[model samples]
Target chain A: MQMDKNSYKKYADARAKKSPCAKNCVCAFLFGGLICAIAQGLKELYMTFLKEDDAGTLVSVTLIFIAALLTGVGIFDRIAKHAGAGTLVPITGFSNAVASSALDAKGEGFVLGVGAKIFTIAGPVILYGITAGAIYGVIYYIVTLIMK
Target chain B: MENLIRIPKPVYILSSASVVGQHEKNGPLGEYFDIVGDKDDTFGCDTWEKSESEMQRLALSRALNYACMKDTDLEAILAGDLLNQCAGSSYGLVSFETPFLGLFGACSTAAEALLLSSLLCSSHMTRCAAVSSSHNASAERQFRYPLEYGGQRAPTAQWTVTGSAAFISTSCKDDFAQAAHNGEPVPVITEAVIGKSIDAGITDANNMGAAMAPAAADTLLRYFRESGMQPSDFDIIMTGDLGFEGSSILCDLTATEGLDISAVHCDGGLIIYNRETQDKHAGGSGCGCSAVVLAAQALRGIRTGQIANMLFIGTGALMNPTAIQQGASIPGIAHLIRITADIV
Candidate 1:
């Protein structure tokens, strides 16, 4: 491509040599959907032993535990490498993020290492997620009052 | 630093050596390396950073040994690495009595060291050593994530080469018949161009090749225009660690200026690893990428009479971890060094 100086970035982006492939997308879709289905199955299983809402929460806890364990055992990243976005589906992704950061920072000493750096990746998600949720709640309240 | 100009006097590379980790040892040029770290890629060190420094130390020592020289014989050691404050070079070469000059060119450290060493050898010093190293583990911990982190690297992400290469450069005018064994062909630095830092507005640290290709292109264009030399004039035109994406961009970028180097162009990043088996998506990168390839492959080729002359442009992304976190685009630089076999 005969690109001008200003268009170098566009030109470079056009030559996306190894972006996630179509196969990767399909794998992510399959893997992510499979995780959700398994979570659903776990929820139903928990429902037999607990209340309906408590079962849903228990399923989430189980998923996070599994993700953290996989990360510590050095398997989650390996799977992420091939699975691509498959492993990045919210609950699992968030768990992996926190666990990975904690593992990475553990060398510096617990107080500054694991304690301070545990939320390095997940911190931004939580901050922004809560902010957006509060804004949504306010809009929902206003909308409900106007409807009445 | 001299830019787009020939050195006042020729500097001959008498000897060189490469030390790599297990991954590079298992690479295509694996056997070409002088030494490889153990199965853990630690080189018997407790930490990855220390191992990186150790690689630099081993590289310089081996280079000196190959040249039949001693540590005291070295006038200076020009070494650098991809670490905070260039710790790899400083700590690794502390045992050497030679005066140390620490350098920081990111991935271009090796070429910058070689370029400066060549100039110093030609003018004032004799037996100047140029060493640069980068460890995958160390670089990852510092630049991206920790060793045990579970996030996947992008397909465009390049694997850092855990290796170091050292070159012994001396003035060709100096006499050294005693150390010259088997009448081996000497590798000489003929010309060099210091790269002007150029930012193509690329911010994705994972895709460094794209960020650096512009700098490589700029330097090559200058060398071609100033020296009035075509790419065909040399046996090969090589880049440091532009990897797959950067290599293609370089070819295209240069073509835009009516200079097509596709025929004679080669990349150190692509030369070191096997794409088929190794999971390195864009191939190997880092200072050691070009350093080892030049030592193990290019210099060997020069010694064996396969390549009479070649242009080596070492590309580097100059973004620090903090700068990337602040959303600053990566600015890249490529230092060019031309090497040839002595006619004698």
Candidate 2:
């Protein structure tokens, strides 16, 4: 059907109502910002609690992992709905993805469910790393042996 | 910075049904070709069982014909489509022994795949990259079922073409690298910004412009701010098919943002089919509309030195049947790619 100019104009006008506005921005700035700030605070507390030299790094990673796990419980989806990309734009989002998958699958069977599912999002990274590493290692061993 | 990398080879582009005559009949775009009568092919996606995957395979085969490496030589395949699971891309890539990464960015999937591939190449993470996109009318049938297997459409709703596009990116010594920046290759991506339109409850497909315009504006504005470049600094600013309305809305929105970008802007939907010829109501749909235009038209323009400093923005309505079923509004996203000539 040929779109008449008048109808097209009406469509265009109706469309204008759906235009993106700063008010409807989906990136939950406040909530995501609060979560990040809290995570930082928790990291500091953990570092101070542990006197070990590497405690800061260790504690931060642990906290990030735990936060990601909470996000995986499907709770983070609600938070993300409210926060839009705010929840997604952070490292915490990645954690949430992995944790959520693992939690959802945990009911299936621990080995395949909990263990395998936790790495769903990060699986590609790990797979590539291991495959590439093996290939590089084999090449290195061959080259060294031949040179000797 | 003086050394530049060229995508080592050219990738051949192939379409399943290249309706090359004005009165071509019985394809996804058969009706369109009959009306338009241009020598251009109305790539019909109407008949293909698995249109997306079929087109993807066809496109990849075409690329392989032009590429130096055999199918086995490819390290991995980066592919996507405007479908759930990126089904077309995944199923197509599955045939190859190489690993695959499925991506979805609505219409921007082609560029997204390329960008990721380029990043991997620039970082020496991969030796080669291939990116492709496809659309099939039958696939739309399974998904949208727009008209009753046969029915009339409002001019606002566009007929999705069944077509696919592919390109190969390889690392090669850059000759154009030297002349442009005195030996330094310009970055393929000087900057990139992704923006999404917040859903405002508009459902009519014709008004996609209003739904997607904000994302386009936000990204374009962000690109200017981040790159510290003005609108005129680039030769052309191309947007993925926004039809006539979205294009206007984008222009208006840009003006509101205090950025005047009227002179160097265009849209894929408006340009794909000559309105005088086909009268494609609102314009083209499906991922192939933008992908084919970028590969066949935009890249040609850049290669011949007809254009420089091109900003290609691919827009997508992040709406699904599920969302529409739930009465949720449509949210759109636009991804930008900055490509410059490697003038030797």
Candidate 3:
């Protein structure tokens, strides 16, 4: 039962089949690009009648709403299955996570279930993201002052 | 070879019951289950944890009713869940006032419970119950995210079954006679092989099928080798919840060992759901996945003489959120039990 590291590694390599990385990558890239293109087009449409800052925010909000709606109706999960990281790396994926958690908790009750679990998935992402950004900002300030 | 335990006396599976959530009830094996909860039947519990306890309570109640016995009639109860510290089983079966042996083998808890129950009944000459459950809400919150999170699931991810199942085993021959009189034939436990932990160094928590497949292959090979039985000896060799991907890996690994079980092999994960129509990417995984499938479907097949003998190996991935976050590999284990129908 005790195998050497080399033998175990070789055995694991033999037993674990190769995943279709090429297919997965192609799908992810194409789907992710297409989603970004759609967002770009939506922004363009809004820019025609709105201020530049307003158009950018409007486009992001529209994408999040669409993603949440798709997730609520169970369509986003299906897309994520085939799209893989393509659908996940986009802002829409974040919306999907929030929406799914809410829908999942809806059965328990709106207050404890939906309200509490609504940010379960997205909460950490936002928390770490802001922390990392602040840390980088402080480092940049120190570096600039030291150089001066 | 060291892990094998051959039952010296007959251990009769007198009766069993399965209760599943609405999603499973709509699946292919829906008709085989004893009870199917409605969409809101979260047992009216406010939390997924409480709902999971309700699932176990209901499943045990139904199984006892099927056997025409109460908690007083049972000597001991073996049960567990996917929750950390196994809160589901403790809270669920506490009211029964029966001595409980709480276990945690991830999704393999069902097989572990059943195997130990058979041993206890065979050695002590008493009746015991083995039960296990897993809820989609509870398991999801524990292992990954809450259901409402709508995070994109990896294609390799499996759907946790929202269900529970119970099996009543007794060494008393009179129980078999009563079971026969009631038109339910008993299945005898012949042997069990305990599995050693096999870590294939798989790091992805989402891809459980890959993490657990090696352990399943190792256990199946060991069971066949130690028992001196070929794949032809049993009608079917089923893995607990390998789903599509893990089942294939198991087949390929076993084939390398000169055992070809592709034709006689099936998976509980695959049997519980329709892959094409269900949208369950890799299929079902969890304690309830195999427990309910075997209780409701395979046992019925054996009782009706559709299946004569079966080798069931429950596979489990021994990993937690802390291990995954620390970048530790998932270690896996599998336990095997042989069940044979008693010829009338």
Best by TM-score: 1
lDDT of 1: 0.88
TM-score of chain B of each: 0.97, 0.79, 0.97
Number of the top candidate by lDDT?
Answer: 1
lDDT by residue (A14-67, candidate 2, tens digit) is 554332335336345676677678766766677777765566566557756765
lDDT of 1 by residue, B249-279 (tens): 8898899789999999999999899989998
Alpha carbon lDDT of residue B174, candidate 1? 43
Off by over 4 Å in 1: A1-4, A44-49, A52-54, A132-148, B172-180
Q: Write the per-residue lDDT of candidate 1 for residues A25-115, one digit (tens) a residue.
A: 8989988888999999999899899999999999999999999999999888888876767888659989998998888777678998899
| lDDT tens per residue, model 3, B1-344 | 27679988989888899989988888999988988876865877877888999889999988888778888899999999999889999999988978899999998989999999999998874899999999997898778875544345656778999989999998887765545345545688889988778888777777788778888888887787777889998899988999877888788778988999999999998888888898787889999998999898888889887888999898898888897888788888899999998853
What DockQ does predicted model 3 obtain?
0.30
Worst 10 residues of 1 chain B by lDDT: B172-181
Q: What is candidate 2's CAPRI-style docking category based on DockQ?
A: incorrect
Give the Å error, residue B95, model 3: 2.7
* Fnat, 2 decimals, each candidate: 0.56, 0.02, 0.32
- lDDT for residue A64 in candidate 2, whole number 0-100: 62
- Extract clashing residue pairs from model 1: none
